[model samples]
Target: MRVHLGSDHAGLDLKNHLVAWLSEHGYEPVDHGPFVYDALDDYPVFCLRAAEGVAKARAAGGDDLGVVIGGSGNGEQMAANKVEGIRCALVWSEDTAKLAREHNDAQMVSVGGRMHSLEDMTRFVELFLAEPFSGDERHVRRIGQLDHYDRTRELPPLPESAIGLGPDA
Candidate 1:
């Protein structure tokens, strides 16, 4: 699979390490990077580009994924989510990483470089890459709703049961 990666100064080291690790593990790692560390560098530029790469690849029918990293990964995740058709999940643990893929069908993941050990963060990435979306009916329905909302700027009507009122009432 093609994995796109981007990070600011805070995550540069981990990003570099992951690039090497991913190659050794038989995954193609594309670095959308700062290249040289600059403390004043912005995360959005690289993160958004990486997210866009994933979106374009998937649109082209290629199997691809993305990873964005920062000090807390909050901004990176936020930036990635702004791109249309991108579902970027901020992953903190193994479970969250797996669930991001299984439940959310996330095309991208964000990780905090300062929050955990290198091994733990890498493990989370591995779990995320390995897990497949559950593809349950409910999950598919929810994803469709989200896609519909994204395409149409209109809210989906709430079900009658959810509104806590009968059809006549």
Candidate 2:
């Protein structure tokens, strides 16, 4: 798998470590980076490129994924999701990492550099890369709703139980 990576100064060390780890683990890692650290560097600049790389590679039928890193990973996740057709998940644990791929079919993962130890984050990424989407009917349906909304800006109707409820009810 091709893994695209990006990060701000806060995550530069972790991102750099991941690049070497990924290569040793037999995955192609693409670095969309600051190259040299600048304290004022923006996450969006690099994260968007990583997300775009995954989106373009997937569109071309390649099995590609992305990782974006920052101090809290929140902004990086938001930036990644702004790219069309990109499902970026903010992963903080093993379960979240697995669920991001299995349930949401996320192509990109965001990690908080300041939140965990190197080993913990590395394990999370490993779990994310190893998991596969479930492709269950419910998951597919939900994902379809999201994709439709992304394309059309149309909201899915409320569930039947909520249809007749008043605002106060």
Work out the TM-score per prediction. 0.95, 0.97
lDDT of 1 by residue, 69-149 (tens): 999999999999998999999999999999999999999999999998999999999999999999999999998899999
User: What's the lDDT for candidate 2?
Assistant: 0.96
Q: Model 2 Cα RMSD, Å?
A: 1.3
Q: Best candidate per TM-score, number?
A: 2
| Candidate 1 ranges beyond 4 A from true positions | 164-169
CA lDDT of each prediction against the hidden true structure: 0.95, 0.96
In candidate 2, position 33 carries an lDDT of 99
Q: How would you encode candidate 2's per-residue C-alpha lDDT over 3-80 as one tens digit per residue?
A: 999999999999999999999999999999969989999999999999999999999999999999999999999999
TM-score of 1: 0.95
lDDT of 1: 0.95
